[model samples]
Target: MPLLHIENLTHSFGATRALVGIDLKVERGEIVALMGANGAGKSTLVKILSGVLTADGGTIALKERPFAPKTPHEAAGAGIATVHQSTDIVGVPGLTVADALLLHRIAEHRTSLFVSRSGLRREAKALIDAAGFSLPLDRDFGELAAAERQLVAIARALADKADLLILDEPTASLSSEESQRLFDILRRLRAQGIAVLYISHRTADLQAIADRALVMRGGRIVASFSRPIDFSSAIQSMIGRRLDAVRPDARPVGNPVLEIRNGQLAATSVPFDLTVKQGEVVAITGPIGAGKSRLLSAIFGVGRFACGEMFLDGRPYRPRSPAEAIAAGVSMAAEDRHRSSLMPAGWPGHSLAATISLPHLTKWYRKGFLFGNRERREANRAISRFGIKASDPLASVWSLSGGNQQKAVIARWEAEPSRLLLLDEPFQGVDVGARREIVEAIRVRTDRATLIATSDPEEAYEVADRILTIDRHALLPTAADPTTNLAITGT
Candidate 1:
């Protein structure tokens, strides 16, 4: 019998049906890939399987026995472990690697509080080594790089002896080399009869790791495939359309809009120079920790630049804060939308009306009291322009899918005229269809000079008129083909 079986699984959130009559099965030693666009019910299904959410109607059988877990701890005890996209669930930031690995064991000792620190370290080392990772056991888990944290989370799952593992966007923060190491580990786990349910937007990862593929759209299972999967068809199933490359035609460059010289992110970093022209899109591509994000932060005035001279339209421009930058005709779409951008509790209109005053969609104060008709009108226009899927314009932004939320945040900058636009990792959790829409929107607006930061070469090729790389704080233009020349400053 298969290791896991589900029949007629259905779930809903208020009026929105997240999952509808989903049926699936996974045998031991099999790796299944789940593909879906944002809000396609992938997160809902995973939550039900991980005990984070209770399915309204469904029958699940594990090892030929009925199984239903009411809590995450219950799910873990039932031999089902989940590693979500964010590593926060692994453990608190202050905890050591050993503590993170054996957190459950530590929590289990309710009566006798005395725990053996030496034993925890030894056990944690064994788990890390078994997972083929050499992470420092005594180091604080939060201080490590994103890829290292990902490995520790996987190691923790293995330590739990979970028979069925669910991984959501596991490699989103990992480097290509680290991603390959993880694929190797997953293969070893599969050889040992561990069933893996993998979720990701990266086609390369799906091809490398998954044995079978399942496509979900509009809260339903639309398609499934065996080995040697047809990825194009799978993507089509997810988005309900033929996915096309989002390459934008290069527009005629105008006079320089912004110029920087002798700029250093920090006193110890290398100095660099760059120039951006109106109607031009320049992409900066580099590996993590290579200063891609640091550059954006400095330019957006969130971080200090050690020494630099900046000019906006041939005038001196140095902003001490984001507000100052905004006043000077500059706008930024931050990297981490959940933390650095967006108010989840706010309505969709509040998010899109942030940078510009869409008078029709913005509420003009009446007798020192606020109204929302204009805000609603502005949000609806943005929603229609970006094809954001939502029941109404007044819906809380937190209710939308990851891709749609990203769209709303990005669309906010387009509400007003800006001389320079900055976008960092704009397509992090977005699918092909949404990525195309976002790129097209940015391309169509030829009045502003835009700077994009990404680690993916394909994304750089699709949207960037010129590609640059950051290394040791130095920004240098890459050859026409970014894939062949990945090195930036050779740090």
Candidate 2:
């Protein structure tokens, strides 16, 4: 019998069938990759498995025993652990790495036996060591970097006696090296006969770790690829269509719109020079701390360079704040949408129309009174232009899927004309079809210069006419040929 077996699992929300007749098996000592697009029912299925939802109809067996958990704690008790895309340690670093790792244990034993701080540290240290994770047990959780923060979460999950580990977008924020470290840990877990269900959109992550690949589309398992997987085929199955035979639409590059001379992103970086022409899309690719977002933020006036000069449209541009940047015809979409781009439904100005019209409210006001009709009109226009799948402009932006939400955010910036458009990891959690739509939307208008910051070279290839890398917080020279990078080389 398999370690985990599911037969005809099905679920629905309202009239929408989020999951339909799903069948799968996970064996011990293996890592299985789950591939799907956003809104393809992956999140719904995961929620059911994690005990956050009950399936409408299905059967799941753990070691041949019927299994149904009613809560996350019950799921944990059943030896199933889920680590979400974001590294979340509850009541943690707010509390030392050790405290975060052992919060539940500490809470359970604190009243029975008083343990000193040093004693708690030692216990946590031993647990992480046993799990083969190298972490500073005494350090504050907040001090850890993004990769380290995720590792701490994984270590804690594994130490809690997880038999089957489910990781969602585990390497979303990790560098290549950091991702390798995570892969190593996962390999060790497989050697110890643990079952792992890994979900990711990254080709690199799947190529590196997945022992088997399962593709899901339309709430069903459409395809599966075994070792020596045909990745091209897997991607085609996941997206359910062949990628375009040619580039979407490549426009001619125009005169220089952005110029940076002898600039340093941080005090510890070397000087660099760069230029972006109007009607061109340039992408900056680098690791997490390599200052990809920093470069975009610098241009948007939310971040800075140690010493550098910038010129927009051949005029010196030095924005002191985002308002100044906006006034100068510059707009930017940040990396994390939840914390930055989006607001909950109940909050004022959270609707699709309001979100798109937020920064341009001054233009919507006449005699000190704003017009909702114009806002809704513009919002509907953006939805149509960007191919957003929202039926109502007045609906909350949160009602959209991850991809649509992202489109809405980018639409917010694109609504008003701008000289330079900045996008940071615009395709972070989106899938192929949505990614194509976003690229198409960004390319349709050639009136402005577009600069994108991302860690994925493939994304740069898909979106940018030119690709540059940064190291040590310093902008690197762009290659004479855009396809010089190995990632850009066609296999």
Candidate 3:
């Protein structure tokens, strides 16, 4: 019998039908890849399976027995574990990895007997080893890098005695190396007869470890494939259209729009010089923690450089904060939508209109005041242009799926004009189609100098006029021959 089985799953949010008649199965020792476009009901199905939400009409079975959990803890106790895109699963900010790894045990022991710290550390170390992770047990869980924190969450799940594991976009924030390590761990789990449900937008990941693939469209399972999958066919099934190459529209480059000279990202790091011309798109690529973000932060006024000079259109520009950056015709779409970008409690329109800091959007007598109709009009226009899937403009930003949420964040930045645009990992959780649309929109506009910071070289190749690498906290050209770094054919 399969480890997990679902039949006729249907769910809705008010008038919006999120999922409709979904059926799926995952057998032990099998790894299944779930592919879908934004708002295709993938997140809704996952939530239903993990007990975060209940299905309107459906039946679920584990080991051929009826199963319906009322809460996440109930689901975990029943041997189902889900790792969501957001790291909020490991909720305690100050908890150590050792403690997090043994959280289940600690929670189970409702006795006065205290557990030994050394003994717990040894146990946690054993669990980490078993999961093929090298995370430091002594480090605070929240303080670790996003990838490390994700690994810690997975380790904790494994330690809790999981039989069916669900991972949602696990590599969205991880570096390539970290993702590979995670793949290795998943393979080990599969060998041990653990059922795995891997969800991702990355075709490369599906190619690497999926034993089978299932494509979801409009909240229904539209296609499935066995091993040796044809990824192009799978992607086509998910989006209901032919996949196209994501190349930015070619445009002319003009005079320099921004320049940085002797900018020190870190106190002890060497200074770097860079220039971006109008109508040019420059991509900076590097591994995580390699200063890609530092460069972007410095430019956007989120972080200060130790010593340097920045000029915007031949004028001295040093922004002390993000507001100042915006005031000076600089727009930045920050990474980590959940933390820095999305307005969790605000409506979608509110989130989209937040980026335009113009007095017209805020002043009472102006046309774009929040209480007036301008913000709503802009939000509607952005939703149509960016392909955001919110049914109502007043719907909370937190209600959208992760990929759709990412689109909303990027749309906010692109809605208004700016001299320079900074996008950091804008494609983190975005689907290929939406990513292509966003890149095309930004590149085709050719109204500003856009700087994109990403860890994926393929993204750089697709959208950038110039590609630079961050090494030892400094930026340098990837190759002397600029043509060699140009977009690939078909792009």
Which candidate comes out best when scored by TM-score? 3
- Alpha-carbon local distance difference test for all models: 0.80, 0.82, 0.80
Superposed by TM-score, candidate 1 places the C-alpha of residue 74 at a distance from the truth, in angstroms, of: 1.5
Where is model 1 more than 4 Å wrong at Cα?
A: 91-105, 110-112, 115-152, 344-369, 482-491
Please, what is the TM-score per model? 0.87, 0.88, 0.91
Q: What TM value does model 3 have?
A: 0.91
Better of 1 and 2 by lDDT: 2
* Of candidates 3 and 1, the better by TM-score: 3
Candidate 3: pairs in clash: none
lDDT for 453 (candidate 3):
88
Q: How accurate is candidate 1 locally (lDDT)?
A: 0.80
Q: For candidate 3, lDDT tens digit of each residue in 34-76?
A: 9998888999988888889988998999989998888888888
Candidate 3: worst 10 consecutive residues by lDDT?
355-364
Q: Model 1, residue 44: what's the lDDT?
A: 89
Give the candidate number with the greatest lDDT: 2
* Model 1 worst lDDT window (10 residues): 354-363
Compose the digit string of candidate 1's lDDT tens values, residues 1-491: 99999999999998899999999999999999999999899988988988989999989998888888889889888889999866756776799988888786768763235657887788788888888777889999767665577788887777677899999888776767778888998998899999999998888999999999999998999999988999999999889988876455645889898898888887888788888889988888888778887787788788878998988989998888888888888888876676556654554434444322322122245465556665667678888899887777767676677788888888777666789999988888787778888888888877889999888878877787778888777786555544333222211
